[model samples]
Target: MSLSQSFIIGQYVHRNSIIHRLDPRAKLVIAFLFMLSVMLLNSWLSYVLSAVFVVCVVTISQIPPSYIVRGLKPVWLIVIVTSVFHIFLTQGGQLWLEAGVFSIYEEGVIKAGNIAIRIILLLVMASLLTLTTKLGDLAQAIEDLLKPAKRLGVPTQEFALMISWTIRFIPILLNETDNVMKAQRARGVRFNSGNIVRRLQSFIPIVVPILLLAFQKAESASLAVEARGYSPGMNRTQLRTLAFKKLDYQVLIISIFCFALLLALRK
Candidate 1:
């Protein structure tokens, strides 16, 4: 599959579901806590529980299971390389294998699995958040959450805008890269075969063009921002003010309850 086909980060799914109806602020907070919980999780049982919980949440979000799974396609490369490093470089417990300079230990294997699962969980939750919420709402939600920091002279609006821009453009950049890849492939350039260095060298054709496109996009965004009289640390109006409703509070309470339940279960 093309990178754009399997990689759906920053894409919003317009669905009328329980999760979609909730305020983005609540969604943001819940996503943050969910990822944090994943990171803190240590045991296999905890991960199994978390994975089940994520599946339930995905169902509730009304996003197709295939979409959720496809989102992990681009992540496999990073996860594989990272897991390899963790398993080979890290050492503890019983030695699983000794191969010259690289030795795999039982603890390293366990740790690598743990970290890979953690990374996947984090990405899944993040993707779910972006999928269920619009970029505008996400940005406004972030600004609302960071409002208190404004008292300390923080440019909360700008910070939120920056994050919004980053998330909003990731998929675009990936699509652009995919287009470049297809173009190169049409010219008989191979990216998936041969030695590591060969594959890296094959990708060099797209780097400069992608960088140029990124710079052009940035310049255009800056020009548009200036045209709109954008200012940092200034009082701004929101299209839709984020206010927690009864349903939002109820979901929050349930999430907290489940978190407590998981904590107790882990203990």
Candidate 2:
């Protein structure tokens, strides 16, 4: 299987740390703010600061760096391609290498470095959120956070439930895909040996079974929810309540501080 096609799913690791104890909503909001700040940054210093911030947050979370990097393996190609294009195609400063129709400039090199750093920082920040927060907790947090949107005529609760279910099922789906691939392999199916078109054709058997199983699971889940008295437009009490603790406040303050610093540095 191609690197991009590999069954890599983000899994939450149980760690007793400040980051793990914070409200999932806080973590999600901080992650979004960090991503926005990183994207807004145009200088290399800002990118470096973002990278440091990511490392610090990951360290505080006590999640293994290996797991975060592993989750990012699928997107490494995209980062590389984007960096290469930025380095070679963008025009600025003195040329480092020049041919009849091609050149590499100093400014492009700096820009590419900044882009690469920002990409890595973004991935790390996202991975940190998934690593420390449970899918169920995240869903609840999202549901609570979106409560305000209900006044705007949006089905915030339903939307939150959808997001929660999707996040909750990602790992399950990945595991299911792995099992399906193994079953196909046992029947002499090779996913990697054929040409592009032939390989795609070979996927039909695998894809069909997965789709059927997904439908089966969906039906079962719907039935279970109905049996539990779940209904649209009805208020539901959650078993676990999300509350912002001292650590959450600390993290929020730090995140806001970092965001402001990043913005100021950008200017």
Candidate 3:
């Protein structure tokens, strides 16, 4: 697929690779730890190492480089906007650029770079998890993780199902939007070529259809779930239970070690 149309956030690719074979709960925990490590790390080298780790994990997942790059397209824009905000607003350190009514300082640049790096690292890690794991597995993983909360009267299974369904619907909604955009374009509606206000106005047709379709899809899914005897607060059994294997243990141990190493590097 083209970079502009790279896979959606919740789209999954099933492959026989090691990363794909990993237990969803294990992947979920490692993902959390990885993001935590990136945020806690202070040194430049530590950030670089974290970035390298992400690259390595992505490579192991066997997802196409183009797909991963495309997934990052939206994130790059946010990074640029936020980085610019930090560069201009943040102050201190040596002056980098001096201009009337606008000045750039060394600290501002560093801060902007720091924010950009953190955003990219987190997005990459999150995208990797979604791309590699199935939504059903993710739901199960979340429910398993939240099992302890069941004692507190929490509806863990329902909560997990809701979270998974929300994520699972993201790509479906995007697809619906694309179909609406295409239909609108066929009727001579210009979304990209118009001025700011015009462009915003052009989406009026697209938005209505998406909203309707979202409700329609949700209604249909609920009906199907109910037909299958699914009910909130009801205990359920899995066809294939998630069990920690040797490989899973090894991966978790390695993940913990990496986080510990990152923590040490921060000091």
Candidate 4:
């Protein structure tokens, strides 16, 4: 996958829609529930209903469907490989194709289709969350959610900070990779139209520089944090505070209701 496509995975896009305006905590809660409901899905009917709900939410969020689809382009190969595995490796329920010891069953095809849809839904929903919420707000929300674990000596703030840094660095690394690849390409390195081994070899120049850059960036980040007098366990204040509002409550209730309906359908 190109770095441009990889860059979209965790990068946040600013917008002024309902999903963008909701408290990050509320959005996180609903996304968590929605993911659980999607994983629980089994039948075609359940998947159809879930897809409908996802579309409705995406429509309301006001993000272009094309953008969401583009974000998923990088993962299409993995999704296809997973679906193929399910289709061929699964055994039982009246064989559709048989060759020697290998057999493709009727059940396998359906199972593969279901698994592919489930994965796509999961990615789309996650992308929606990242696209609508700011990284700082997401970090704060994660910290708020993990606050209870601090009683057990967990480093909630540090974990939240790590999460925030991770999201922040994704696009940085991707852009760096793109730059490295373009430099290599300029020197007549063929990334495409090569055998698997040759293609892997072509990436060596790109990978080494990326690792060095990553370490350098990490050191710089550490120094910046220390210079700011950041202590591991110290209380930190945010410029913006998160609070739940009427819209958040309404969205939560509706999300929970839909999740319940999905569960009931699955049962």
Q: What's every prediction's RMSD, in angstroms?
A: 1.6, 3.2, 1.9, 1.6
| Better candidate number, 2 or 3, judged by TM-score | 3
Q: Who wins the lDDT comparison?
A: 1
Assess candidate 2 and give its lDDT.
0.81
Lowest summed lDDT window (length 10), candidate 2: 1-10
Q: After TM-score superposition, what is the CA distance of residue 157 in candidate 2 from its true location, in Å?
A: 1.2
TM-score of 3: 0.93
- Residues 147-237, candidate 1: write the lDDT tens digits: 8998999988899899999998898888889999989999999998999999999999899999998998899999999899987657888
lDDT values, one for every candidate: 0.89, 0.81, 0.88, 0.88
Question: Which regions of candidate 4 deviate over 4 angstroms?
Answer: none
The TM-score between candidate 2 and the true structure equals 0.84
Error of 2 at 121 (Å): 2.1
**Cα displacement (Å) at residue 1, model 2:** 12
Off by over 4 Å in 1: 99-102, 265-267
lDDT for each residue of candidate 2 in 113-228, tens digit (9 for 90 to 100): 87887777887776677778887888788888888888898887778778867766676776777789888989999988868899888888988888888888778878988998
lDDT over C-alpha atoms for residue 224 of model 1: 97
